[model samples]
Target: MSESTTDAATTASDDDAVAAASSSPGLSRRGLLGLALGGGVAGLAVGVGAGVAGGVALGRARAAEEAQTAYDFFGAHQAGITTPVQEHLHFASFDMMPRTDRDDLISLLQDWSYAASRITQGLEVSATGAVGGDAEEPPDDTGEAQGLPAAGLTITIGFGPSLFENEDGDRYGIADRRPQALERLPPFVGDDLDPAHSQGDLCIQACADDPQVAVHAIRNLSRIAFGRARLRWSQLGFGKTSRTTSAQATPRNLFGFKDGTANILADDAKALEQNVWVAVSDEPGWMAGGSYLVARKIAMLIETWDRVRLSEQDAIIGREKGSGAPLSGGDEFTEPKFSGTAIDANSHVRLAHPDQNDGIRILRRGFNYVDGNNELGRLAAGLFFLSYQRDPQQFIALQKRLSTDLMSEYIRHVGSGIWAVPPGAASGSYVGAGLFA
Candidate 1:
């Protein structure tokens, strides 16, 4: 419950003071429950009136407990990566303004980190947030999420390859420190990527149970960016396609098949260490505890897919639609039997399975998205695929293998990007500060 964090505007030695100054008083479940039981003497004094008050307090405490699903902003690794996937996502990419210097970059990070720490705790971007600021000035917060709980919100920031070096030529002077595996992903077999949505210098992944809370995080953070960084392209997603904990039931994609059944869970630290977190022995030591992020905007042809025969649909996905079990038999978690015709030779499950890919695995954290209707009256909907791994090659290999998947006939890879997710910020410091160190 300590929830230690930092202040973006100041880097003093007293981290507790800085955190207290930035954070609002959180109404935790324990605190509220204690409040319900604390009015003992006063309750006895009022007799029946006290009983009525106690009932109201107990009810409020239960509601607050259900709403208070918070995570710390400061840790060994950034939250949201392995955190149980949230119900909604507001993923945004940003580019540092032209002619920005190293100091500008550092200051921007400091400010972002400070704001993230507060907002993730269900507080505002600053102490004078929303209605607390001067009447004449714009409030630090956008105010949409006022009176809301944390709802398990998490804000994760990543550094795109362009941030280290770009067409502008080492704008921040740390070009040599760029990770070898942190380059733009090579063109895939059938990528119709839009230049506008493809890449950026930075990416922020904000997720929460409440759509408004997720949107509020990005809205306020984008506002804070102001002159330092500009929004490139953003995505709003719902119905997570993957879950990071065993407690969560596997969610389905737009195509209606259970997705991420074999996903890496938060409890699997061994798999994470082996396949997700970058090791200290790896190159570019600044990213030792960090991971690589790959995002792909896949437009699913649900209309076309919907018309296919049920048998054909099952064949394409290599799983039973109802139970999510592999065609080879057994329940959802059954190791797929690819040896027989039960599973198609070119089925999605077969091709993307780790058994066929040399044990290569990436932790998936994707979500389903819809961009309204297109001119043809078709829903511009798709799967926003997000995966994190120790190296970018893990994604590249799996994607290359899936190029031949039967499901590929109904999906198109549009927006794509790769970013280096630095480790978490320590107390009293901003994220990615070690890059400057």
Candidate 2:
């Protein structure tokens, strides 16, 4: 037979072999489960003890056929702020090592930007990825997410007050460029912050639909920063407490109350530009399109809250738990009647409402977190509060108003951080490139 005919016959034979293998009763459910669980080739080999090669081939084929969701990494503003709130979050704060200089910091940001862009697109960290380099050298990626989908992952970077001017003084030579609005927050009325989790030089907010996908983004980025920066503190969150888009249903907190009823939606460009984005006149031109982020780890006194009467809970929250409506009896989206008799003067909704705060509004993208049971055998659960605003003062002012709310009795503010999130990086450029320029 001619070469062309021989090639056609080989292709037909391969197709038949695949069809036969797929129909074979010997292909066990355990093998398929291992593949579905992202066990990769090795797990498939172990799962199908006698059919190692075939199992590996099957796993690869399944991975190739899997669908993935991706978000654009390059944009006017970094994602995870205005992006629709994801189901899971892996937030990490990092402090630059004492020896890392300005140049080292810049290089690390560039490398992180490249890796973030690729990983968000469902690709490996580098062209020569896990198991691709020399036999002796460490792999580029950790490979825990080897065949996993991107699952709509977004990684957002931020620079804290310490990044620009730490106690050491002007470490990055950009102290003058730091925005005046990026200062450390003043002590609030009820803050019980732990020193270990209060501040950091830099922070990464990674969000995704899958927990592993979120964890993988932070893990790989932390790995890449090994010598330059070290993890200061991290928080894992699930069950998004707020929605950034109108399409998503408002999520509930551990208290079973609908949270973020009046949150700024992503589609509200006017509200976003006026309340979230930093304009050129805001100072430090590098942050023209940026926003300030406030993260508060609010620990809920779950046992105490659970024991409270339902009527008392409703009075404190100022909303009906069942409908998330104002106590005055309107729908969830109705304007809250702060003046109504049903609403208490110190109710949470009354204090948090923009109508009560000189029309000031901030975008909320918080989540409910359950770290574990504390030493007291009580569930250490609470809201991982995240808010983005044009200025840090927005959060400070709002939080000040909340200090007197009746809900304060049920919650204690523990971990806290403030960050300046610069505008998004354009294609072929790294995040915070303008700061370096």
Candidate 3:
């Protein structure tokens, strides 16, 4: 902790004492109030001490809990990357149906807050006390702790537009996904690409030190939360080909980066809206809170890419052969000049001839999966790419250009799926619901 934080703790201890001095039996309330108001001992010293103890306990508790849940949230020691196994799993939401009895759903949804607290990881921000649930008890309103993740594992629950409305416009949640998809999807199943966590339309992601432990915990959570054993997507990662995937559990993106950079962080709010929010917003009352486009592409051919020359490969991706930077370059964010396009006639970008002016940019979040050994006795894996946008056409534009781009020589796409990430639930509710309404 910083000196400033330590100093603050010391100061609060005096406040807590002053506040508690008045009442002995009811002092806990007085102490808490004083801390919040005067930055008292509870708020400052005792609070800081409590926080540390709490955080450590929370972390340990999460680890224990995850031992039972599948899909480890713990950090693995093998590769260079550092992220809870659960954190690496990607998530998005779609629309669903709302409850006729709003209060009941809210109560049950609020019960989920405890579960949320048990699994959310590294949550930096809280979405605001807008969370409504559990009429028996209200959820605590605080900074990052407002929801869960205090424990090692983390939970990310998404809602469709229907979450905000009742038959008369009350707040409640709903479970939803495309109708045709429900039958094929299991309640909680391992993904073809990522076998760590159980997959759900609205996933409760988790992670822990042990993979078996994590998955076990997750499986239990599935039974408790949804009341069903499980039903998940049959295949979750790269579409099957002659190659193998994650049988031994190694991680890599389709591009073959030792670690592919993630675009989860945007430049600003505008970037968030541009990069993630869908353009269409008029809810037909029934579809009121839904989103419009999900661009899913199973990045095929990274296996073939693993076999190419360093120089030949670098020219295609237009980044440092190893650094994952611009060909003309700087770091990941630097701009590359198209002027360097002539460096190699057979280069990937040269043949693709992408220009900042004409070339479209689509945000990318992808990871590589090392299936089993390939024909060469080497691990075979490719990219699992997902992008969200107001319009998927932009992604299509990039693909059209890439069709003839030099990168195509090394990459081959095998599967594609798309769906809209329905809009967030209205104030005082979580998302998903509308399909059944």
Candidate 4:
């Protein structure tokens, strides 16, 4: 997870940290060293006491280890798109409040970027946010994540089509700058989309290994938005369904089968350039290094799916139940043989394969979600499908082809959104800063 996206120096440090943490015998000595590296000395000097040095060192050492999982919030591209998938996700959508103008929009993005930078580093939204502020006034931070480590948090922000213009017209004076592909997704064949959960003027995706940390990031950012933007809808998800690096194991969705086996990994720079990141030479130069994000809230009919026979399930997925190998093939990572009837033509694997889609590919970062039981006592659970592509047409074409997918009978697309995620902010700038430039 650490090797592909980061610099060589960062990778080497991560390896050493992992090695030290794994060696049981060197734990104590290494813990103390890690503590010092992680800022434990300040605590000791501030009267933590020499007597409890060992205990304090151990605690900080664990925190330092967690820090190894952290990714820089400001980078060549947004962190969450290609960063290692975390175990939890808190995705939110927002709409600009009525009559809000260009300044409000710009300030909101600036505030969100500032807060995200601190939160990803395991700090409060501001240095004096949670508790350091005046006792008489409300705290800038919500305080739920007080003592927690960063836990690999990444907060990615994006702009929906409505941000540039809406029914009233160019609200932010950037309608001319909007990419041609940035528009509401056309209704798909089997879509049962709910308007309440569909589009937004902005979106924030907060992911972390710890649920509280993830929630906290969104909560505080939501607070910062205040009258500028209001939350449209949000979803909490867990059990990541995709992997961005080979070091990660392919995760399973709510369904029993493995998912995203052929996803674009971070190490595949060529594939990323071709299918994921936008180039400066592309139509919208502001979106260079960025990607289009499509989010679908697919609701699964658990009771029906549970009753399907095991053999039929395998046939629908085009893979073995025990191992994720292709029906015609070897192990999980083996290239699937799709030429013959060995794999069903209508199977998900066959239809969604790159070969079937004109060699097109996408980077997936999906998660499984359970929203408790419905009124009929049925489980309300499904996959929150998220994919980043260089262009919106990549997803539109894929979905058009999957309209005939056999598995569609057991699932419904209830929510949909598409956002043009801007490239990472340089120091002292905000996400989407180029739109106003």
- Top lDDT hit: 1
Kindly provide the TM-score of model 4 when superposed on the true structure, using C-alpha atoms.
0.87
Model 1 sits at a Cα RMSD from the real structure of: 10.9
lDDT digits (tens) for residues 1-437 of candidate 1: 32211111122223543464255333223222222233231111100112225557777775455357777677778888888788788899999988778987887787777777777777777666778867775555668889987777888999998999888899998999899999899999879999899889999999887777888888767766666677898988888999888878999998889999999887887899899999899988989878999999999887999899988999999999989999999999889988788999899999999999999999999988888888999989999999999999999999899889999899999999999999887756778988999
In model 2, state the lDDT of residue 227: 64
TM-score of 1: 0.87
TM-score per prediction, in order, is: 0.87, 0.85, 0.48, 0.87
Q: Against the hidden true structure, what lDDT does model 3 obtain? A: 0.34
CA shift of 20, model 2, Å: 39
Arrange candidates by lDDT, highest first: which order?
1, 4, 2, 3
Clash counts per candidate, in order, are 0, 0, 61, 0
Which stretches of model 3 miss by more than 4 angstroms?
A: 1-87, 90-118, 121-218, 224-230, 234-264, 279-304, 329-332, 343-361, 374-380, 423-428, 433-437
Candidate 2: regions farther than 4 A off: 1-67
For residue 201, give model 1's deviation from the true position in Å.
0.2
- For residue 275, give model 1's deviation from the true position in Å: 0.5
lDDT for each candidate structure: 0.80, 0.78, 0.34, 0.79
TM-score of 2: 0.85
Give RMSD to native, each candidate. Answer: 10.9, 12.6, 15.1, 10.5
